[model samples]
Target: MTERILKPGSTLGVLGGGQLGMMFTEAARRMGYGVAVWDPDADAPAHRIATHSFIAPFSDVNVRDRFARIADAVTLEWENVPAELCEWLERGCPMRPSGAVLRVIQDRIEQKQFLSSRHLSVPAFSIVESALQLRSAVDRLGLPAVCKTARSGYDGKGQWVLRDASDVKQVEHILRTANAGRRWILEQFVEYVRELSVLVVRGGNGAQCVYPVVENRHERGILRETLVPASIPLDVAETATEISKQVVTALQGVGVFCVELFQTTNGSLLINEIAPRPHNSGHYTLNVCTVSQFEQQVRATCGLPLGETRLLSPAVMVNLIGEEVQAVTSGEGLYALHATAGAVLHLYGKRIMRPGRKMGHVTFTASQVETATETARQFIARIRRSS
Candidate 1:
């Protein structure tokens, strides 16, 4: 296939019209490009911003062709979109990161295998195909292990942690009720010092750029905060950058990739997972980096030059979840954070609200990450008080 560079007026097609798609469309539109999005929801956030919105199922042939017909290149904000649909679009227009990349990344088992094939470090994992396999994997991996669905699980959904032998019954019940007749992976839980993520973008020409490492904090398996230029040893950050580049290179596709890593107490890094799109942790880049991760995604997919990822300041990002959204709507102190200096708020126009659902995020820049984090904490405390 010949490489083609898309000009400013070219149309970009996006799959999955969620907040990520909305942000990607915003970036593309800002750079004089047009965006067409295909998603089932008519009220999706991206629909309000995209140049064209196909409100139909991903498998609908007409909707798929309409997207491909108008797009010079197609990319996705989420990995769970049907791989067959992506492959079909590939025949009509270029698909960034490729359908093959989606197939490998959409499944936890395949992702781990790919990492292992590249000699990358990952936790011990076993695939469970049946009740017998689940029990055996739990017994082998021991207590405090996590049982996760092999596919379609995110933000702690479709996951159960087993801390003791007695938890086995609860795990079995969850498996039967929540994931009946589906494949799962049992992984040995890592007692990590901190969680880190590297956002790397690789272009069609094999050129790549790495964003500064960000340390993440999760509440109940959902990302809550991210601190850029993670307060780790310089050598450790360098190592993570190199590892993230290797993962993107191995993917053999063009687009932004988010590699989540676990920093163990022994100071070693292990691959936790990979997302082939602009990630939640990379949200700080929109405020503190020379170029946002969403813009980098558009640049890489369109065969444009990868943007600078130099951090403009020490930054912290706080996720405004559904619970916080409720508080803010009720005239709680959560809305008072809008007055915070050096803070930038981005609210996704999502109507539905539920516990743990991501509604938006706020980023704060400061001379030091500690100061930025403290300011974010104050806002979080205010929101918590209302809850």
Candidate 2:
């Protein structure tokens, strides 16, 4: 393939209108690329600064055509966008890290197949399309497994973990109720040491860029904090980097690719899941890396040579889930942190916050790991109290 680029001042189309889209738009604008975004919500953050906004659902043909006509190239913020919709746009304009990437990622069964095809190590999993299939999967995978939907599931949604023998009946019941007996995957659970992620960017020519491995902390399946330069064995990190590259290659991904991984108790690396765009783990890059994940994503998707993904310093990040969201009042525990120097706070101008909703985040660096971890913990404590 020849080197291709979407020059500055070119318009980039973005799908979805959440913070990720907002950040992607901001990155493109900073690089002199005009951004056109499509989202059903008129007030989406990306719309605030986009060159143009096409207000419609993800499946709206008019919105897709408008994006194709306006943007030099197009990409999505999330992976759950319907494959058929993405395929429809491919006839007109580029929608990348490849709509095929989205198609595989949106379904766990396809994702597992993709990974297995690459010879990447993954937990034992079986697809369940019927009650008998579910029973067979249970028999094979055994007790203490997870049943997850093949599509449109995130933040721990559309998933159930089975630990007890009786939980098998409960999983079948839940799947029947939820999907009307649609297909799902039953995966063996891992008693892992920790979760980690790597964000890789591959340009049109396969020029790959990688961010520092991030150690992620999760609460109720949502991210809590991400610490860069994750304290792990050097080999563990290297293996993760290698696996990420292989995954990127397998997908023919042409933008940001986030590889969620698990460090097993026995020190082996196993893939957890994948995201075909800028990820929450890479959020720490905004303050700690030379090129933020947002910028790297735009550059990669636009066919520009991706910048270095080097780290500036050891960093810690804490997510703020504040209350008083509806009232716009400061919710719990802001004062608990009272962070001194080098602290960066980013609040998403959300009007209201209920429990578990991400309100904002704080990121900063520390010379010592203990200090950084303590600071991040306190900052989260502050937000916890407010909520």
User: Each prediction's TM-score against the native?
Assistant: 0.96, 0.94
* Global lDDT scores for all candidate models: 0.89, 0.81
User: Cα miss at 311, model 2 (Å)?
Assistant: 0.5
Q: After best superposition, candidate 1 residue 22: deviation in angstroms?
A: 0.3
lDDT (10s digit) by residue, model 2, range 1-387: 776678898999888877899899999999999998888888677788889898888777776776787877888898877778777777777777777778888889999998998899998899898766888898888888998888777878888888887888877776667646378989999889989999989887877878888899988878888888889989889999999999998888888989999999998889989999998778888888899989988887787778887788888987766462322233223433343456777666655557777777778678776687887776565445444
List the pairs of residues colliding in candidate 1: none
State which candidate has the highest lDDT. Answer: 1
Candidate 1 lDDT by residue in tens digits, 1-387: 445889999999999899999999999999999999888998789999999889998878887767777988999999999998888889888898799999999999999999999999999999987767789998788878988989997999888888887777777766666546689899999999999999999888898899999999999989999998799999999999998988989989689999999999999999999999999999999988899999999998788889999999998898989878665555535456656788887889999888888998889888988899899888788777776
Candidate 1, 225: how far from true, in Å?
Answer: 0.3
| Model 2 error, position 141 (Å) | 1.1
Looking at model 1, report the run of 10 residues with the lowest lDDT sum: 326-335
Give the runs in model 2 whose Cα sits over 4 Å from its true position.
322-339
Clashing pairs in 2: 325-351, 325-352, 325-353, 326-352, 331-386, 332-385, 332-386, 333-382, 333-386
